[model samples]
Target: MKHLIALATALTLAAASVLFSAANAEANERYGKQKVVYHINYDGGQDDKKYRGARRNIQNHSNAVGAENMDIKVVLHGNGLGLLSQAKTNEALRGQVLELKGQNVAMHVCNNTLKGRKISYENDLFDVFAEDIVPSGVAELSHLQLQGYTYIKP
Candidate 1:
């Protein structure tokens, strides 16, 4: 009976150690590195919930990965352009964008929309750069996914 009790105790300790190690490894993996693409295609006017959710999604993602440990990109296109519209680019939006930028989040606008809507990037966008403009928004999301980026259309 004593030997059996000792064996059981040893087995329990080994199992506990393994479980602890596995949990630690998982935590490390979560913070190591991650890539994600947020797809925003609906106009804020028509889809207020989605727009708000997208911002919340960004915040939640940042919270999840410590913001500093993850790479995030928000791809805006079509009606989604409203989110970054010159008129809509208020202090809150700019602050959020700037904050995310500081956290290494890249915001890419759709060049196709700019061309189709005759929107001047210089006058219409907040802090978007030329290189940040992708050829097509949908295609960009697909490409990012293919490149192992997790897509979140919030």
Candidate 2:
């Protein structure tokens, strides 16, 4: 009976491993070619660790799907503007953003928030351009969803 239980456990583990491998392969092959939008709202990430996890999530997504296979964007609004708020003084954070950009990830900031905060992108954010400003971050996210981009709020 003990041997039977051990064998059962081993088989279950083996089956799980096989299933995981197949799923990972499909992730790398099938839906790797996908467009994804990551949404950020200030309220969710109350601390740096949570925000950093979100950033790491994006990098992991790229790693899983292959950066070239993904057209990714990070959309920030409301208090989420903190995504770039400390960029000037935070070299590590700035470097992470740039690395993702190097992978062709676009970072979108809400123009509405910028206006409300009295920020000029040219002078405020670490590495932002006029093209990166979405008139409304939520609306942009909705539009991207409409256009078949998978939305992830990390």
Candidate 3:
């Protein structure tokens, strides 16, 4: 009886693994290779929950499409810069940003916003560099869309 139970458990585990793989394969086929840009323009400092939700949405989208098959860009402008600023102090938000960065999600900041707000990318924001700054966030979004990237605002 013990041997039979063990065999059954092993078989069940194997079947479950196969099912999971099949589901992932189906998702890969459905999504294929995608270029997606997520837009953010709200102040996370005022409403951290919304910004956190946006991060979650990005992660969920990546998971659904498979990170390897995704080209994800996060365009931040205006108050959206608060997302990274909050991350500097909020451990949870910082971890999420790092995880997304690890998954190859590019975070682009608006040069105009930086100048207008006088926020230093080198010190004020988390993990941002000069290369990450776009001349204008709205223009960048439009350019990305013209280049065949699907726009998503979450």
Compose the digit string of candidate 1's lDDT tens values, residues 75-99: 9999888777733446666676677
Cα lDDT of model 2 by residue, 39-150, tens digit: 9886434456666888899999887887778999889998777778766667877888888899999999999999998988888778889899999999999999999999
lDDT of 3: 0.94
In model 3, the runs with Cα more than 4 Å from the true position are 1-9, 45-47
- TM-score winner between 1 and 2, please give it: 2
What lDDT would candidate 2 get against the real structure? 0.85
lDDT of each: 0.80, 0.85, 0.94
What TM-score, to 2 decimals, does candidate 1 have?
0.74
Per-residue lDDT value at 144 in model 3: 99
Question: Candidates 2 and 3: which is better by TM-score?
Answer: 3
Model 2, stretches more than 4 Å misplaced? 1-27, 43-47
Query: Would you list the rank order by TM-score, best first?
Result: 3, 2, 1
Q: For residue 84, give model 2's deviation from the true position in Å.
A: 0.9
Query: Residue 26, candidate 1: how far off, in angstroms?
Result: 7.8
Task: Give the 10-residue window scoring lowest on summed lDDT in candidate 3.
Answer: 43-52
RMSD of 3: 1.8
